[model samples]
Target: MTTTAPVTTPKEKTGAETALADSWRVVVLNDPVNLMSYVVLVFRKVFGFDEATARRHMLEVHERGRSVVWRGVREQAEAYAYTLHEWHLTAILERNETD
Candidate 1:
């Protein structure tokens, strides 16, 4: 039988390091153009959030005008932001911060 070597993660290598030392942010912004119901629906359809969670986020957008919806690796965050844009929502990617 063939054997494979175990894989090690970055966090495993650097025990004291923060995971987001190299992570990215995905921000979704509010828009007057989209209906509230549509925003909730899109959040649910795109991120698989339930109605309550999606509605909460949509409400946050309505009140605050923007929200950092997700955080992860840069490439993934950029991809997600782009996907949200394709869905006609405003989105952006930024480097995650420790502070």
Candidate 2:
């Protein structure tokens, strides 16, 4: 008797899976350790935001416990979160539930 190999094919992603894959957010949380000015500066440097825009995000993080700084695909969101962590900022990745 001869044995035959089985073929395998890649599966397509479902709508929910595709939505989840495209939904990610990078958030910065306020911490007593870092100065507000520093956070603003970092935001500007990392995201190329203008002084006003950076200050706006900084204020959001300061007043509100956290701020969603960026939203995009998982890889880039993770990268931004990691980079912020490297900068000694309180950053985290979150799933965008609305997606």
For candidate 2, the lDDT comes to 0.92
TM-score per model over all chains: 0.78, 0.79
**Tens digit of per-residue lDDT, candidate 1, span 2-24:** 99999986656463345657588
List clashing residue pairs in candidate 2.
none
Clashing pairs in 1: none
Per-residue C-alpha lDDT of model 2 across residues 18-78, encoded as one tens digit per residue: 8787899999999999999999999999999999999999999999989998988899999
State how far residue 82 of model 2 sits from its true place (Å): 0.7
Worst window of 10 by summed lDDT in candidate 1:
11-20
In candidate 1 the C-alpha lDDT for residue 37 amounts to 94
